[model samples]
Target: MKIDVHGHLSAPESLYAYKANLLAHRGAHGRGSAGVTDDTLRAALTEPNRTFGNQSHLRHLDEAGVDIQLISPRPYQMMHSEQAKLVEWFAEETNDAIARTCRIEPGRFRGIAGMPQSMETTPERWTKELRRCVTDLGFVGAMLNPDPYEGAAQPPALSDRFWYPVWEAVCELDVPVLIHSAGCRPPARESYSLHFIQEETLAVAAMLSSSVLDDFPTLKIIVSHGGGAIPYQRGRFQPGALRAGITFEERMRKLYYDTCLYTRDSIELLLRAVGTDRCLFGTEKPGTGSTRDPRTGRWVDDIHLLIEDIDWLDDGQRKQLFETNARELFRI
Candidate 1:
C-alpha cells in the first residue's frame, strides 16, 4: 500500500508538436487538437528514453516497491505564462494525457490535474478546469503553480484575496492542492529548479503568516520539495511569529510536505519539523534524483529505501510515512 504523491507525467510527443505549432502561430492558427493517439501514447511510455519519468515507469515503481503514484503534468511544461487561450488549451491537453495514463492503470495511478493558471486569469477562472478534472475526469487533486507569470510578472501571493475563489472551490470539492511552480522566463531569474524552492518557501511563509488556514481550515496544501527550506530555517521567523501572538510551528503543522528530499538527513529533519503525520511518501522518480548516488549505489529517488533505513522511525511512524498518511490525504 505504498503511495508516492509527487510524480509527473511524460506527455506524448504529439502534445508537444501541437504546442510548438500553437506557439509558432501565436493564436492566428486558432486552437488545434492535441493529436495524441493510443499508438503514440504506447510508443511514448513503452520506449526507452533518457529518463524513465514515463518510459516504463510502472516497472520502475514495482522495482522500487511503490504500489501507487499520483501523476500530474510536469510543472516546467505547464506553459502558465502564455496567453490565456493558449495556456487553457495546453493545460487541457496536458491533463488529458495524465488522465489517459491513469486510465491505462487505475490501480497503479491517480491523477493530479495541470491547471491553466495564465497570468491574466483569476484563480476563479482556473476552477472551471479544476472541476472538470475532478468530476468528469476522476482526478484526485491538482497541481497549483505559485508563479504563473514565470517571474516576468509577480502575481498575487497565495494569502491574498485573489486566491480566495480557488480556496473556496477547493473546500467545496475536497481535493488537495500541490504548491508547485512552473518555468522561469526571465533571463536573469533563477532556473525552474531554484525557482521551485524559492516560490514554495515563500508560499509556506505567506500562508503561515496570514490567516489563510484559519479562514479555510479544511484546505489541504502539500508543498513539494520537502516544504522548501521551512523545516531547516523555521527559527528565522519564530521571533516575528512570537510578536504576532501565534505559534509558528503550529501553523506549519497545518500544511503537508512530501518526502522528495534526496538525502536521509534532510528527510529526517522534515519529519522532526513537520511530524510524520504531516508527511506523505513521495518519490519524483525518473525526475530529479534519478541518477544513482555515488555514495549509496542506489537511485537517489528510491526514497522508500531511505525511509526503511531510518532507525529512529517507529514501525507505526514508518507505516504512516510509507502508506497511511497518503491514503488519508488523498482519500484513496
Candidate 2:
C-alpha cells in the first residue's frame, strides 16, 4: 500500500537530441548527469550511467518499497524551456514518453504532464495542449512551478488572466493542480535554507492572495514541499491575504500538501496544521545527501522513523498518511 507521490525522470526517448542542451545547462547544484540526445535518450533509459533513466529510477523505487510512483519530469522539461512552440513540443513528447512507461507497469507507475507557461503562445494553443495531456495522454494533471523565474525577472504571475484558459481546462478536467517550488531565476536563496522555504511560502501565499483558487474554485491544488510553510504561517499571515481581498480558507481546505519536509517533527506539525487527509507521502527521493550512512551500515529510511514517532496517530491515520491519501488525491 506504500506509494510515493513524488518522483522524477528525464525524457529518455530523446536524450541524444538534447545532449548539447543538457551540457549547456549544468545543474544549479554544481554536478550534472550526462545529457541525452533523442536517439540516445531512449537508449539511456535502459542504461545505468544516467541516474534519471528508467532502470535507475525503477530500481530506487523498488528498493524504497514504493508500490507506486507518480512521476514527473525534472524541472527543465516542465518550464517549457526554450520557447512556446518548442515548449509545446517538449510537453507532448515528455507526456507521451511517460504514458509509454506507465503502460509497461500498468498500475505501478503514473505521470503528470508538463504545462507550457510561455507568454508568447496563443491562449488556444495552451488550452489545446492541456486537453491533450488530460484526455489523450491519460495523465492525472499538470505540474507547475510557483513562478517560472524569480524576482522582477520572472514572467507575470501564474494567476494572470493570460492563464485563465489553462485554468479553465484544468477545472474542466477535475484534476489537481500541483504547485511545485523551483525554477526561480537566480534561485534567490540557498537550498533548504530559511530563505528557500520562504520563497516557496511566498509563492503560495501570493497565489492565495491573488485569489487564484477563488477564481477557479473547482481546480484542486496540491502544494509541494510540505505546503511551503503555509500551514505554519497561515494564522499569522492570513490576515494580510484577507485584507488584500482574498479568502482561501474554504479553497485551502480543498488543497493538499505533500510530506517532503524530511523530518518527523516537521511532518507532525504539518499534519496538525493541514490534517492527515490533506498530506501525501513524498521522499524527494535521492534528496540532498540521500546516500546511506556508511559507518552505521544503514539504508536510512526516513518515513519509518516518522511513523514510529507519531504514536498519537492511530493505525488508520498512519495508513492514511502513508498511502490512502495519495491514492485518493491523485485518483490512482
**RMSD for each model, in Å, please?**
1.6, 5.7
lDDT score of residue 138 within candidate 2 = 83
* Cα RMSD, model 1: 1.6
Query: Which model scores highest in lDDT?
Result: 1
Best candidate according to TM-score: 1
Model 1 Cα displacement at 299 (Å)? Answer: 1.0
**lDDT of every model, 2 decimals:** 0.87, 0.62
What would the TM-score be for candidate 1 when compared with the true structure? 0.96
Backbone clash count, each prediction separately: 0, 12
What pairs collide in candidate 1?
none
How many Å off is the CA of 196 in candidate 1?
0.3
lDDT of 2 by residue, 1-332 (tens): 78777665535544434434543553333333333344544443345433332235455556667788777766533544345555555556566667766666666677776666554665556667667877887888677654444332555565677667767888888777666644444344544234336556765666665767778877777777777777776787667657767654543555787777766788888888767888778765644324555664433434545655788998888788779987776787
Lowest-scoring 10 consecutive residues by lDDT in candidate 2? 26-35
Worst 10 residues of 1 by lDDT: 49-58
